[model samples]
Target: MTGRATPRSGALFERAQSVTPGGVNSPVRAFSAVGGTPRFIRSARGAWLTDVDGHEYVDLICSWGPMLLGHAHPEVLEAINEAVARGTSYGTPTEPEVLLAEEIVARTPVEKVRFVSSGTEATMSAIRLARGFTGRDVVIKFAGCYHGHVDALLASAGSGLATLAVPGTPGVPASAAGETIVLPYNDRAAVTAAFAEHGDRIACLITEATPGNMGVVPPEPGFNGFLAQTCRDHGALFISDEVMTGFRATREGGWGLDGAVEGWTPDLMTFGKVMGGGFPAAAFGGRADVMGRLAPEGPVYQAGTLSGNPIATTAGLATLRLATPEVYAALSATADTIIGAVVDALTAAGVPHAVQRAGTMFSVFFRDGAVSDFAGASTQDTAAFAAFFHAMLDAGVYLPPSAFESWFVSAAHDERAVATVLDALPIAAQAAAKASA
Candidate 1:
């Protein structure tokens, strides 16, 4: 697939900007970091995205962590089509929603669930539930682990907001911000200190199982277990914000961190991305006792008109069904291939860098040594990354526009797509080297 912009794409972006903010639905799509007009995607299939110019490039960002099976997979499309024939939003209960919920509970092994429209909604609702469940106001979150735009959790979010370099938005009331305490990721001591000071009134400690916002920072040996233990000791609820890491990290929704990571579970879990299958579907669940306290049974008020829309649930169900063990193996293998190739290319080019990986997710950090915390991740050479990003784009490749976001690998990223990335790396590396110099 060649990455050439069609005149139509350029025209679309120009027109879009007049109406939409930054000429894109999301911020990073504007290619602000890379310094170019964003490509207008006409359609996507399998591992490739076709721009309006009739150009195709291997997709590495994977729609920012959904489209695990790739865009418009026949199976997923069929599921979506069938669901649409039955009518769209019901604003009430649907059988597909029940089945999807059942599938999620069975797979993630959560006791109960509440569906929401987006990852933001799922996490925002989870935070409210956490506060209600624990009867506390303070929330503990890591600096780089983004849990959507939920005011309290936005202390230091990743993704587009990170690329824009905003600490936190201005509209959030200082009173709301006061309840949030941002701690450095992968630093056990920071967590300890926060709990020591505000353990009593702390309702929940929300965090990503593996920090993806700051380029995929995995827990440093037993850190997650420590959080679980700390929450238990302090009478706080551990809320795992797996909106990004959910099914993308593993079939069990980053809970693999608990078992493979020291054998413990958080009191609440939020999920989105892969579960949505490229649509707006997300959920939060945990202990039955806690989830039971959500609505008719309890007092925490949270509702959405399209919470469990049939099409979204069907797409989610189809996506989850395809993420079997075999699919996960393919995803891991592809991620390893792309990341390993990038690492080798950078080393050969003598570019200073480090790469982080968690399951099928990875990121290239343009910094020396490891990035263990938000401060450390921030040390990445953004100027250099911006140059390399455009170079890769020119070379018919798509990378996460910012140095702070994780690159997703899907089962659809076959050896051919991985090979295309490997081919593009040398150019990207050279670009990074010059930009750094």
Candidate 2:
């Protein structure tokens, strides 16, 4: 089969660069890593994306994991439509927000919930609440775990300041970064050391329940449980950032995979993506007493003008209600087929790679061994992945543009979608092998 042409997408990209930064709102959408023009999606339905050029491709990104039931799901659309008909935002409390909050509280370990506009807000608020509740200043996070672009959390560890961190980006102040302790993922000893050194001053230790940002690097056995207990021992809050994994990675988010079974729950949890049903909605919540500290209640202040926008909440509530056990089962089955195909194709093509999974979420690393930390994830063959990525794109399969991100599948990824992906993998794997050579 011949490669699909993206002339319209290419033209739009060139035009967009004149006004937008790098021709995209989000950095990854610029396709800097893959060396190609990003596809301008015209519309999406079920598991397929129709680019502006009128080329159709099986969508594997699923809008970075928010389209859990898939794009433009009828029920979700109807709910959103109804909400829009009533009103968009009212600045006053709404029934949808209340109902959504109740649903979230029931599904997860949180006793109280506060709505936010984005995942960044959810995490940012959770961190503030933790600091206020504990009356501490320091925070700890893993190197690979991404907890939004909050100033304090946007930090990188230095050789000299192994436990302490320095600003990872220009805008983040050094003082803000100084309050964070960045450690390697799956490393219990480093976490122990950080706590021992700054136990008294530590406010919280936050992490992705099963990090997907660095290609779905799952926690080692008992790692999350250990972190939870460690925070308890030090009187610090354990905030689980489930912005990507919430509701999508098992019904109770990443907690259902481990914490629910291990008998440990995070002091606070941040959620987005699947919960929002493709809308700009997110939340943070936990023990009622700890959450009681936020605004109009105790001391810490956090508020948003569009905090519980009715449309967003209604969409989220509908998505959550429809994400039944059967939907998760279908998602898992589809993920299993895709993961297996990827491994088989890569192995057959003699391409060195490792596939890591956390429930339904997973990623393929162009390396031989398992990836447990960001350091390990960084060692992937990006040149090879770039080759494979373009090959898949050419073959009408839309994958996440970057190698260091999770490949998502939705319940809507039926047989046809899976078949499209499966057919593309072998060719893409061969491309990767050639690049490696």
Candidate 3:
């Protein structure tokens, strides 16, 4: 297949760069990792995206995992339209917010919930609540587990296992980074050591329910349970950031895979993505006692003017209601078909690769081993992935622009969408092989 023409997209990008940094609001959308012009999508429906150049492609990114039912789902659209007609934002509480929060609490382990405008706000507020509830200062997190760009959480691990972290980015102050302890993912000993050394000062330990930012590196068996127990022993809160995995990974989110089965639950859990139904909505919730510490109830003050916008909440409620067990079953089956085809194609092309999954969410790493930590995830052949990515994009499959991100599938991914991806895989695999050579 010939590469699709993207002249209009290229033109728009040139114009955008004059005003916006990197010509994109988000870093990954810039396609810097893949070395190409990013497609400007004009519209999306079900499982396909129509770019500004009038070229159509099967959408595998699914708006970075928020489109669990696919883009512009009819029921979700209707809900949004109705919400907009009623009014966009009202500073006072709305019924949709209450309904959405109830839906979230029903599916997950959270007993109470507080809305936020984005995943970053959800995580940031949860951390503050943790600090206030425990009267402690230090926070522990794992390397590569992105809990949004929160200042304190944007930290890099120091030289030793339990050493204090340094800022992962330039703007985060040293004092903010000093309050965080960054450790390796899936390394229980490092977590134990960190807690052992700083237990008295530790307020909480936050981690992704499954690390999707580093391409779906799942927690080792019983790893989450271990973290929960360690935090409990040390009197620190355990927070599970499910912004990506919530509702998308499974009906109950990543907690369904382990915490629910293992009879353990996080003290505080953060949610976004699918819960927002592709709108700007997110939340943090947990035991009522811990949540009670927030402002208007207790001392810890956190407020947002547009936190529970009715339009976002209404879309979320509709999406959750439509996401039945059957929808998830179809998503799993579609993911299985695509994963098998990818493995087969890569093997035939003599490409080394590792495909890891967390429930329905998964990613392909351009290497041959199991990836348990960010260090392992980083060892992927990114050049090879970049080649593969462009090959697939050229063949009309819109995957995530970066290699280190999960390829999302929605319930709307029917046989036709799956076939489009299958047809592109072998060629993309050969491209990856050539890059490796």
Note the clash tally of each candidate.
Answer: 0, 0, 0
Question: How large is the C-alpha RMSD of every model relative to the true structure?
Answer: 3.7, 1.2, 1.0
Best lDDT goes to which candidate?
3
Identify the runs in model 2 with alpha carbons over 4 angstroms from their true place: 1-3, 160-162
**Native-referenced Cα lDDT, model 2:** 0.92
Model 2 backbone overlap count: 0
Task: List ranges where model 1 is wrong by over 4 Å.
Answer: 1-6, 156-167
Q: Please tell me which model should have the higher lDDT, number 2 or number 3.
A: 3
Candidate 3 regions with alpha-carbon error over 4 angstroms: none
Which is the winner by lDDT between candidate 1 and candidate 2? 2
Sorting all predicted structures by lDDT, with the top scorer first, yields 3, 2, 1
- The TM-score values for the models, in the order shown, are 0.95, 0.99, 0.99
Candidate 1: give the clashing pairs.
none
For residues 56-110, write the lDDT of model 1, one tens digit per residue: 7888899999988888889999999988988988787999889889988887757
Question: For candidate 2, lDDT tens digit of each residue in 1-437?
Answer: 23678899989999999999899998999989888788999999999999999988999999999999999999999989988998788999999999999999989999999999999999999999999999999999989889888999889985643468999999999999999999999988888888888999999999999999999999999999999999999999999999999998899999999999989999999999888889899999999999999889989999999998999999999999999999999999999999999999999999999999888899999998999999999999999999999999998899999999999999889888899999999999999999999
